[model samples]
Target: MQPLSHLESFVRSAESGSFSAAARQLGLTPAAVSKNVARLEAGLGLRLFQRSTRKLVLTEGGERLLQQISGALGTLSDAVAGAAEAGRQPAGTLKVSMGQAFGREYMVPLLSDFLARYPAILPDWHFDNRQVDLIGEGFDAAIGGGIQLTPGLVARELGRVHVVAVAAPGYFGGRAAPTHPSALAGFDSIVRRSSPTGRLRTWTLRGPAGEEAAVEGRPRMILSDPEAMCRAAAMGLGIALVPMPFALPALQAGALARVLPGWYADAGPLSLYYPSKKLLPAKTRVFVDFVVDQFHARGFAERMSGAGEPVA
Candidate 1:
């Protein structure tokens, strides 16, 4: 690697247009600045500057060298500054991946406050259902359910992802709600088809007392997306098995009602996944902490775990 001192002196002299001015900037003697530039030129086998009695002017090669090296020097300086700042504060782009429905419903709403708290950190979020290769895709973090933990990746559980059956209030206007998981078999249901396997899914539900039942429904409509299934149920199509996050809003709005209340399918933990780097970026650290804090504060953990009692 070329000496940073040599490159510094060369760039400083080029920008200042004289050895003496560059010396003032570097806190070095004019002679030392001139020596460093001369050494740099000799090392590169080029005459970088044409010296007159009045001022030093760039030769054609000098102009090209300046154009090339100036940007590199700036980049190097920025890298050094960023490294130093990493110890001091969270700053820079915070790239996070999340499911579209979850991010929109949960995270995007909190961004205003997060940004206000950390003005230096810019949020770059990708909303998609596909499991991203966090390191390979250059993502700082991800939040979702059922993300397989790969080597060098660590996960912090935000909560459990439990699936529950729900339907529009109008759908159950006259019909009685299912009192148990087995009763769900009698209802017309909107169900998910596994996107990867292309097979219809059965809802395997666990009651509050730890009873498990797999209910196969007469599929009124088969869909893969959870949001779509919830919407279908909201339109009074049929009961839908959906993640609690997707169902909660409609449930709260009274657009939908929970069916077989205590029974839910345990999909697994919802987690925030990030690289297990020894020195995590401050941006990633703060973001992870912030979101986790919000989840706990909102009782999202409990709600996601199917603790929120269904409305009668």
Candidate 2:
């Protein structure tokens, strides 16, 4: 029988279409992953992949074997990991993916404490602007908003993300601040272009009276990132609608002022996502618990919800 490691190497390489990608996910050298796959092939007396300089093409036999073993291998691996480390300190590289701005501003602050508690765990975090495939990419966890919940995954809601209109104090140049969402159209606006769909994003603001108003700016500037929009607004460019998390710092620093303080757009929930397994990994479990605790203790949920803002 081939070792589980050999099978894992083969499966991961096939799934990723490259030995180097598999190696990165597995935390192994490319040479080692290739050697393991070679060993598995030799033992079975069959070629699993037709390798080229660019990518690995799975052979017919490889496809059949993968279909037969993928689920079983995952089950076995989860069980083995749980049973083997039931009482042991979780010590391994913990891979996670998160949005760059949110991860840097919020999640990164927790690193020091996380490391202090689990000194043996090494953090390997990837900061990205887009959603990532958690299980397919072999990430231990991810954090963001608006991620579609796929099979074999679960989410823990962190907070309601709210979008508020803001601008530099001097942006309006003595023009009266907008009293309603509809008034925003008369002003120059810094807006966001949706990354996944190449369309301009629109905002609908909800008022205290349960009334809603759809609004769009004059498109003085367009950016793909919320953080950048916040910065552009702070630089006296134009009014911008940005998520509370991206605007909080500037708002706190008095660099930006709310445009329509009584209204805000309901974006979505920020969440921590991970694979749903019968026996979750110790590192992931601890990290999840710690984050939930921190968020509650810090009142981040309320702050991000626009509930903490004083109504004008």
Q: Encode model 1's per-residue lDDT on 1-312: one tens digit a residue.
A: 568888888887777678877776566888998999899888999999999877889999999988988777857755774588755767888889999999999999999999999999988899998888775455889998777887558999998888888888878677777788777778898989988688988767888888888887777888999899988898989999998888888888898887887788888888999976555667887888898899888888777766446422
Any runs in candidate 2 off by more than 4 Å, and if so which?
A: 38-64, 133-138, 148-152, 169-175, 195-198, 307-312
Worst 10 residues of 2 by lDDT: 303-312
Query: Which tens-of-lDDT digit does each residue in 83-111 have in candidate 2?
Result: 89888998888899998988898889999
Give the clash count for each candidate.
Answer: 0, 0
Q: What C-alpha lDDT do the candidate models reach, one value each?
A: 0.83, 0.87
Q: Compute the lDDT of residue 234 as modeled in candidate 1.
A: 89
lDDT of 2 at 235: 91
lDDT score, candidate 1? 0.83
